[model samples]
Target: MAHSPLDPASSLPTGPAPRVSVIVCYLNGANFIEEAIGSVLAQDCSDWELVLVNDGSSDESPAIAARHAANDPRIRTLSHPDGRNHGVAAARKLGVDAARGRHIVFLDHDDVLRPWALSRMTGILEREADVAMVFARTLYWAWDMTIGKEEMESSFAPFPPGRLAGQVMLRDLIRWDTRHPPPCSIALRRDVLLATRGDGALWHGMYEETALLMKILARHDVWLLDEVVSSYRMHPDSMCIKAEAAGTLSNETVSRDRVRYIGWAARHVAMDWRSRLLALTVWLKGEAKLRLAPRR
Candidate 1:
C-alpha cells in the first residue's frame, strides 16, 4: 500500500527529538485540539515533544487526537485506563511517563502557546544553572478565539536564591493573589515533576496547578519569563463558571482548594519569623472560617 498523507511517516520528519516535552491533560477537548497541537508544533525551538493525555473524554477528543497524531510523531497520545476520567493530576503524570525530553511544559486542552514560549523560557533555565522550574506570562484568549492582553502572574516575588522565596510565598499565601499562569505557561526540568511524586491529592478539591506550584516551590528556583507565551481561553463551559452557576459543591471545593494551597505554604515553605507568624494567624483564621461555612 502506498503511504497516505495522514501518516506520521509522511508528515513528520524523524531526526533530532526536542529537549522539551509539553504535557496536555485533556477532557472532552475535541474542538480545541488542533489549536492546542498547532501552538506547540509552531514553537521557535524545534526540540520538543507534545504529550497529549486523553483522560477518557466523552466527545470526539480521541478521534480528533488520532487524526493529528497520525501525522506527527512529536504528538504522543495516551488513553486513560479503562476509559475513566482520571483527573488532571493522574493524566499529567501519565504524560510525564511518556515524555522523553529533559524539560517539560504542560498545556490545558484549550490553551495555545506562542511560538517563542519554549525558546524563551528555557533560555533562562539554561543560563541560570541552578534553577529547576520556570514560568512566563500568559496572553488571555476570549471564547471567540481572539487575542487578549498580556497579564503578569504571581510567583514567590523577586528574590535572589535563598529562604526569601519561601518568606514572600508565605506572606502572600492566603491572599491567593499571586499569579503564576496555570501549568500551560510553566515549564520545568523533568526532575521537578519526578521529585513531587505527581499526586492529585496535592490539589485536594481544586485543580492541579496550585498544588504543583507549591510543591515546585519547595524544591526549585522558579523564574518569571515575563513574555506572554500562551493563551488561556475563557469560555462559558469553564469549571469555575459552571460551579458558580450551579451554586453547590463547587463553592466548597474552591474553598477547600484555597486552604490546601495556603496550608502547603504554611507547612513546607520556610519563611522569616514575622512571615511565619502571619501565615500561622492567617491559616487559623481561614481554617476557622471555612470550617464554619455550611456546605451545600
Candidate 2:
C-alpha cells in the first residue's frame, strides 16, 4: 500500500529546512530511477533534500525509492491517495507542497545532474537576490548513455551568460526564437514557483513545463549559465519518442497544445504588448502548421 496525501502520519522530512529540494516524479520509470537518484546523491552540495513522488508506478520503482530513503535521511517518497495515477504536473505539485526548501530543482527519473550542478546553481541563487530562477545548458545523451562529441560541443547556450529580464525570456520562449533549458537544468526559488504555479490547473496536459515556464518568465528574472549542468537521456521509452513511434505525436497535436498554452498564458501571465504580439505570432504559426500538415 502506498502512502496517501491526506494521511497526517505519512513520513516526511522534518527539522531545519534544507537550502534546496530536488523533486523527481515518475510513473513506471524503474529502469532509470536508480541512476537519477544516484546523480543527486553524487552532488557535491549536501544542503539539499530529495523528494521522490511515485505517480502510481506499478513497478519496482516505489520499492527502489523506499530503499533510497532508508539509506539516506535526505530522501523521502510520496504518492497520491490509493496510489492514483495523477499526471506529471500533479505529481510535481505533490512534491513541491511537501518540499521543505527555499530553492527547488526538478529532475526527471530518466535524467542525471552533474556533480557540481547543485553547488553552482545554489551559489548563483544565493548571490543574486533578484534572480527568481537559474538554468544551465543540458547535454542530450544518446541511448547508450553517452554524449556525442559534437552534441557536447554544442551544449553551450547561444546567448551571453548573464541575468535576463523575465519578459524577454518569456517572449523568446513563446516565439520559439531561442533555445530554452530543460527542466533538469533549472533551480528556482520555491516561493516564485508557488506563485507562478497557482493551483497547477494549467499544467495538466502535455507541454506542462512550457506552461510553467511561460508564467515564470513573464513574471520573474532568470539567470542563464553558459555551462552544462545535467544530462537528458534520450531513449525509446521517453514520452515524445513513444508518442512518435505510435504515430500519436504530430504537428496537429503540437499545434493544439501550443494554442492551448498560448491562451492560458494570455489569461494568466502578465505580459507586455510585444510579448503578447510574439505569442500571437506563435499561435498563428502553430495554426499554419496544423493547416499545412498533410493528412495521414
Best by TM-score: 2
CA lDDT for candidate 1: 0.67
Top lDDT prediction, candidate number: 2
lDDT per model vs. reference: 0.67, 0.80
In the range 110-190, model 2's lDDT, one tens digit per residue, is 999999999899889999998999978888777654312124422333557889888988877776622577789999999
Residues 153-270, candidate 1: write the lDDT tens digits: 3343454323225334435534553355766787788876786764333554453466566566655556656567888877666654554555532333346445545666566544
User: Residue 176 in candidate 1 has what lDDT?
Assistant: 51
lDDT of 1 at 133: 73
TM-score for all predictions?
0.79, 0.88
How high a TM-score does candidate 2 get? 0.88
The alpha-carbon lDDT assigned to residue 240 of candidate 2 equals 55
Clashing residue pairs found in predicted model 2 = none
